[model samples]
Target: MKERETWKNGKEFLFSCIGVSVGLGNIWRFPYICYRNGGGAFLVPYFLFLAMVGIPQLLLQFSYPQYSSSGPAKAWVCCPLFKGIGYAMILTNSAVAIYYNVIIAWTLYYLVNCFTLHLPWSSCDNIWNTENCYSRTYGLASMTGNTSSYNTSIPEDQNLKTNVTLSSNDSKTATEEFWTYNVLQLTDGIETMGTLRWQLLLCNFSVCVIVFLCVFKGIKLSGKIMYVAATVPYLFLTILLVRGLTLDGALMGLRYYFIPRWAELLRPSVWFDAASQVMYSLGFGTADHIILASHNKFHHNMYRDAMIVPVVDAFTSLFSGCVIFVTLGYMSSTFQLDIDKVVTDGPGIAFMVFPEALSTLPFSQIWSTLFFLTLLMVGLDSRIVQVQVLTGSLGDLCPGLFRSRVSWTSAGVCLVAFVLGVPFVYQGGMYVLQLVDWYIASVAFLLIVLLESSVLAWLYGSHRLSEDIAVMIGYPIPKFWQVFWRFITPCCILVVWVMGLVKHKPVTFGGQAYPAWSVGVGWIISLVPLMPLIGNIILTLLKHEGNTMQRLQKSIKPLPEWTKNLRSDQNSEQNGDILL
Candidate 1:
């Protein structure tokens, strides 16, 4: 028996994986990185990384979990020696999901408020007129429930730069162009409204309820929901793209987005950024994707769909960048601000800059409604996937605890997740967004990709892996994947990882301090997968009689499915029983 699926079937599985993979990262990170890295120049390393590291690592992530019928922790049981790495992924999945879902809830909050035609942060004294709240006044509240002065700094033009007068006898001025500058409302950093703690709590709770409703059934239900949720955002985004591009400043935005700096295309850091984006956006090396996809039927061509997901994701990202830059150009021209101030990406881009832009548009209320509603719907799938990964991990690891005997196991998990989310419902939930994102989504993910690729490509023998892929595909994989997986791909990931280490610095922001313990914790967090690798090497090198080392050192046998078809052909002269 296949046992209870605890989720959906093939198509639903694919949709769910796509749903998680195509979330906020595509809309928020892709375009900005593309803009800053090298515009069209960014595409080169992106495609290369997708083919080599991105797609291959994705394949590995799905294949292991699906075959093992395990969650993050048990998926690598064949290498139980490194199961801690899987545990790390589980911890990340849970921690990130809690905070990430809070952000989704914030989107829902904004979407709901848009129906009120509220321009709560319009910075205009005339705001709250509802008819022209663009002209209204608003107040800021701090976390301790204190009020702060508010300003209506609606920019008159979006593409202006700040200048400092030279303190010289002749009163001459000199400008040094820094990379942080952008095209609109061109301030360097925009902090969240720290005084809005109550609003933040309301927003976080609102989205949490929606996510709870969507995910209560896991992937099967969420998959069908995502068919709409995942597709709707693109429709709205496309509308924005077409409308924004047709607007007077669209070309200016396009020029800003794609005008490649040849020198920038050569930077090693650019490739690293592009690689990281692909990893995150494609759900490469993510246990979350595997758990969702484990529900795919044995016969599904998920590998082909896997290829399609990244390509489709990349297209959406580029499309969004064009749209974002166009609107940014308009904002810049309107407010006399530079693009850099207006073009921040990731969480801040979605939560703040885009909302600020919407506050400036004609029929701003309607546009705000469309924009946030689309994001709410689009992001729901992602939040659901994260929750499902959590439940799936818990369910698989202790089946009786969450399975038939424990009817409320699912509810227990949802409660735990909700509880985990409470601390983040602060005034600066967006700051919580960035902090959790860095901790749960960044360095840990990179370590897994590097470790998994090294094991699969170099240690496991890619030639045999290619043969298995050919068998499943019913056609030989293109020579490109074979060579890419074996050498080019793994090498690229290693280079990126090493370079990141070289470039890494202790993180600090806004003159706030992180303790020495916090810094040590961060380093410990980064070396998560490698910590076990030391033991694996020791096990392999030690020689002893009847030792766990010998048993642990043995390479995994190929699954029965891999060899059965070959034996089926030779059965005329051979024993079928042995094969069975």
Candidate 2:
């Protein structure tokens, strides 16, 4: 076998980390989480956790790949028993990559339609719009009790409560109808497969092609693409922020975002949300950090990279929140609605609310096009990292399969991802996306992180790991970081895990409960990645050449491939001091 490839330089690795760490979550999830928790008060816990838990955990994971010079799966070579963590990461990432592309396809679908002089989502005249479709002016007028009369012609069978009607007080906005009826063509529930969405399938195929071309040459081409991908989103964000601040009620939105409700600090859920957000936003436990750092030169300053990436991610989240809330503030003022009514998180904010707000702006088409394009770019950067994690890990494990023809291997991976994502293009696909997202992306992620920390800090020894990191970075490891990694961070993770389980609620979409079978399937998806870990333990006990205790100890021993020079140096230095 041949030697593995390292990043050409530190900048390429930094940009790649930025591309992976800063993702759609920062744009969509963080703002809403802030708004939902305690507005400005949420930042207290967020920053606290970022310092105590986020950066330390990130540094811990970051050091492994660079020190071992291997992907997440292979990075566990030191303690082969926990190697399942790497396999679990691969499984989790593969599942995420499949559904995540579906979102990119949705963004592409929206982006393509954004070119017209009259935005499709701005008017209620389309086939998807119902009799109840209302403009911002109409909504504001309705809120003020000066509602205009309009024809309400509808069949009794279609007179459902959820259906928006002109006669009803609650009417659906054009953008809402566009997202639900036009873009998604969503079914009533997950039980129905409905029909394939041809448009979305085409977009998904296009996304696959774009991803393949960008990374087909591996990091050589991808590293250069990272320069554009990592930096362009900020430019787009700055433009949106300038435009958003100029809108009426922009101050009110900012007030809602930063003005803390001090009482919320007492709530445990707020603290939990803050901790969870740090983990999610920082890309910890996803193994993307490990895989990306693995490509860095052996002596690169990953300690510095870890610190820089999380700070950049937090800044991006704050910047994105400002941009989003400014638009939402305008939406609220235009409709004479409260900020809470106008604000939403996840796909609702990105696909529905933001687009609705954009329709009312001057040069609506231009702004709308830019907004969706921004989404496409952010999603594209994240998707590239996810693809890299899978391909990189596989390349590490099976060199023969990928080494001779890296481009072919990459194309094959993209094709498989596209095929796996097809079910999400069906009318009921959104439900599948929601199910997988809720189960795999939340508690499962934290559990994986907790296990990884335990194995590394306790089993592998944080002191030894610190010595390795110090040697690589040419600096002494901070005392606080050592304490955080060995104790504080793990305790914090356990608390968050327990809190999440206590507050766990059944997954729902549009306030509708999922069928039991679908929920069962979701749980199954969550456990699938964990299967390897369980199997590895059982096999270690059964197959190893020793008694139970001895076999268990043997399983955790460092592999011969783990770098031994640093540990040997530490030992030699100690012996030399004793001799003196």
| Alpha-carbon lDDT, every model | 0.61, 0.83
Predicted candidate 1 versus true structure: per-residue lDDT over 1-580, tens digit per residue: 1243634446676666667777777778888888889888888988888877777777766655554456675565545445556666666666667777676766766676677655554442221111111221132211221111111222322212222211223221000011111101122222332233455566666666777677676555677887787778888887877767666666887898999777787788898998878877876555778777556544355578768777777887887787788888877776667777678766667766676766767777877777777677767778777777767777777766664432255566657766777656543343344445555444666777666666665555577666655544456666666677777777887787777777866544434544566566656655563555555445534533355645545523333443433454356337644311
Error at 361, model 2, angstroms = 1.3
RMSD (Cα, Å) of candidate 2? Answer: 5.1
After superposition on all C-alphas, the RMSD of every candidate to the true structure, in Å, is: 8.3, 5.1
198-292: candidate 2 lDDT, tens digit per residue: 99999999999999999898888898999999999899889999999999999999999888988999998899999988988777666888888
For model 2 the local lDDT of residue 511 reads 92
